[model samples]
Target: MAFESLASRLQSAFDKLRGRGKIDEQAVNEAMREVRLALLEADVNFKVVKDFVARVKERAIGQEVLKSLTPGQMVIKVVNEELTELMGGNVAKIAVAAKPPTVVMMVGLQGAGKTTTTGKLAKYLQKQNRKPLLVAGDIYRPAAIKQLQVLGEQVKAPVFTLGDQVSPVEIARQAIEHAKENHLDYVLIDTAGRLHIDEALMDELKQVREVAKPDEILLVVDAMTGQDAVNVAESFNQQLELTGVILTKLDGDTRGGAALSVKAVTGQPIKFAGMGEKLDSLEPFHPDRMASRILGMGDVLSLIEKAQEAVDTEKAKEMEKQMRQGEFTFDMFLDSMQQMRKLGPLEDILGMMPGMNKMKDLKVDEKQLGRVEAIVTSMTLKERANPDLLNASRRKRIAAGSGTSVQEVNRFIKQFEEMKKMMKQFSGMADKMQKKSKKKGFGLPFMGKSAGNLPLKERGPGFPFNFKPPFK
Candidate 1:
């Protein structure tokens, strides 16, 4: 939901263009005007917006695009490409040192979530099989070093501290030696931040940079601060010659001005983004995927990556077999819900699917999933495995245990049975299709050999139950 308002406004502008049979330059100009206002309202830097709209207009008015069969879509394509280019065209990877112990200096103003992002970066490195040592270099702020130490402990990375007695420059220099001695692959120096940009802070950061000779100097900025975040990045880049930026609180930045403006202003790519407060919420910034999301095209690649990371493959295969056999049950339903929860919030997950944004009335209440899980959990093991055992008395007991009315329990059961029947129909159709494919001496493209070979299970739940649709 970072660019919720901006995306909605932009999509609205595009919608009007799409409705036209053929667009003239005047119509294109009109749409661009709307786009300009939308971008400005989103808090994008005014000059950036002017240049962006000008570029889009120049291309959109070209004969090649205006004469295209789908001129409207052509215009949108141009906008998407330009937007992606503005955001850095591609993912910016973290720098690696030629030698071991890559030193990264994290700098920013106070209250920008710099310390927390340092810990998140350490966790990201650990996932890449690198041993990262976190240095507690923020000695000025109250408990800044302690905060970094807590984060290091949470990520299981060793924190090197000089007890706030030594100068940050010396601490950073010694921390590198410590990392070298321990054979750590990366050394993250959490430098102190001030309430605002000041000469004293810049001088101290400069000294630390001189000693550490950091491979990367990343400026962390809060996305919710709008253009102030961009200004901070510009100031830091001027003094530190920052290699990249880390945008935190991006998930909560509805207007997303900083994310849209920072790279353009600072001439640095956003290397990472903090999507949530969790230590694992940090992700490599991908501009192309972000543009796709802003245009309501959905980020299928990121969604697939998240699924591959969060969902167990073997378990998914086993669940697939159960679906093919029409053997899904309450236990399977509970398990599937738990797996889905690991992928993040339901609304965010749904937003990643193509065309989901167009479903204006679609609502995904995460609490509903939790409630369903509670109902399933209240059931006895035998009841969970065998739906037929959920008689009236048992339904009442489950309803009571789950803090719901018996009528709600009955409704859930009815929906579950309907879902099972639908799965059975799908299973039979799949079998017939497979047989036909074998007879034709060719495999179905969508149903690969791995999926087609999954044998049926005698007893299990049907495919995970589809929640009641919230579509109006």
Candidate 2:
């Protein structure tokens, strides 16, 4: 959503070159001109935009078009790769200290989402099974300490506070000792933030750094700051020796200039991105995925990787085999749903899909899936395994049992039948694809079907509209 305007502008620029078989120098120049304006409008740093456009032009001009591909797509691909390179090509992991109780000091300006990001980082580390202790090192604001405490409670991480009476350096030192005593693996010290750069703040941060001996000093910055965000990062890095940065408020209506500027200017990988206000909304920064999302091309690679992490491979293989044999049933579908549940919430799962984020107008009811789950739970084991055994009396009983109308039950059954049919067709296609992949060693990018053009009616009973390509 934050990248919507930029996505539209870039898409339009590329659309102009869509059908061109060969990208001539003139065409590339024209496209680059549009791209330049788009980036500027998106609040990108002037120098960064210039350099980015130059690299894209260098790769796009006179490049031979791929078979069955338009020049626009090729240019988009080049821009994506350049964007990825500019943002750090690979994912960066937080470094653990050689010693125990790895210290992480957070530095940022006021309203930069520093306190929230501190909590998100704690949640992230805790998810990795690390015992983290959050220290309220911000002595200036009472509300800041309370916010950290609330966040600490939310994350179920311990909060260390010395109240507003103590100096931040003393609090940080004591917090580190507490971390050592408790055998906490990580200590996150949330320090004070100023609205702007000031001498006193920098001096205070330096003092806290000396006391904490932080393994990593992460500068948390708001993505909405545009180019000024880069200046903040630079100033922080210059004084605090920041190891990395966390770009927060990325889910806000930001111009995306901060994200582009921070990494390129500071030469520090963006360690994480704050995608939403939820405590669990933070995600490890992925350059390629972000690039794809910006260009409106979708981030298929990250989506597949997320699926790999979420899905049970052995069960997936079994399901694949069953579908190939046209044996996919309601039971199999339920099992798959349960497996998906194991991967985290459905919303998070869908968010990682390539074009799913683009479906702003398509109101897909997530509650319907809950209803299906409820209906499935209401079914008996035999009914779940063999839907053919459900006669009229059984259907009526199931309808009553699920607290739904008989018509709803009938609709569910009809939808299940159609899903089974679709699964069989999909399986056949998948089998052919598997054979082709075995021969070629590179699988198709997608299912080889355009989900973008799917008819709304065929998208399942409760589905409101055709599925977008995935994270559009």
Model 2 spans > 4 angstroms off: 58-74, 126-129, 143-156, 181-183, 194-200, 224-228, 251-255, 277-280, 312-335, 338-409, 420-472
lDDT of 1 by residue, 1-472 (tens): 6687888889999999886668999999999999999889888999889999999999999998889998999999999999999899999999999999899999999999999999999999998999999999999999998999899889999999999889999999989999999899999999999998999999999999989999999999999999899999999999999999999998888787888899899899999999998898899999998888888999899888888889988988797777777677887777887888888876777778776766666777666667778888999999989899998999999999998889888988898888777677767766765687676654422345444334443122222445564334
What are the C-alpha RMSDs, in order, of all predicted structures?
3.5, 6.2
Q: Look at candidate 2 and give me any clashing residue pairs.
A: 353-470, 353-471, 354-470, 354-471, 354-472, 355-470, 355-471, 355-472, 356-470, 356-471
Predicted candidate 2 versus true structure: per-residue lDDT over 1-472, tens digit per residue: 5676676777778877877766667887888999899889888878889898988888787435434267667777788889899888889889898888999999999888888888999998987889999999887865999999999988899999989999999999999999999899999999998889999999999999888889999999888877888898988888887889898878774468888777778888899988778787788999888888877667667657656766788987786566656575667777776776655555544545666555555444556766676777778999888888888999888888888878878888877777767666665655665676666564422322342233443222122112121121
- Residue 362 of model 1 has an lDDT of 71
What are the models' TM-scores? 0.93, 0.74
Clashing residue pairs, backbone N/CA/C < 3 A, model 1? 327-460, 327-461, 327-462, 328-461, 328-462, 329-461, 329-462
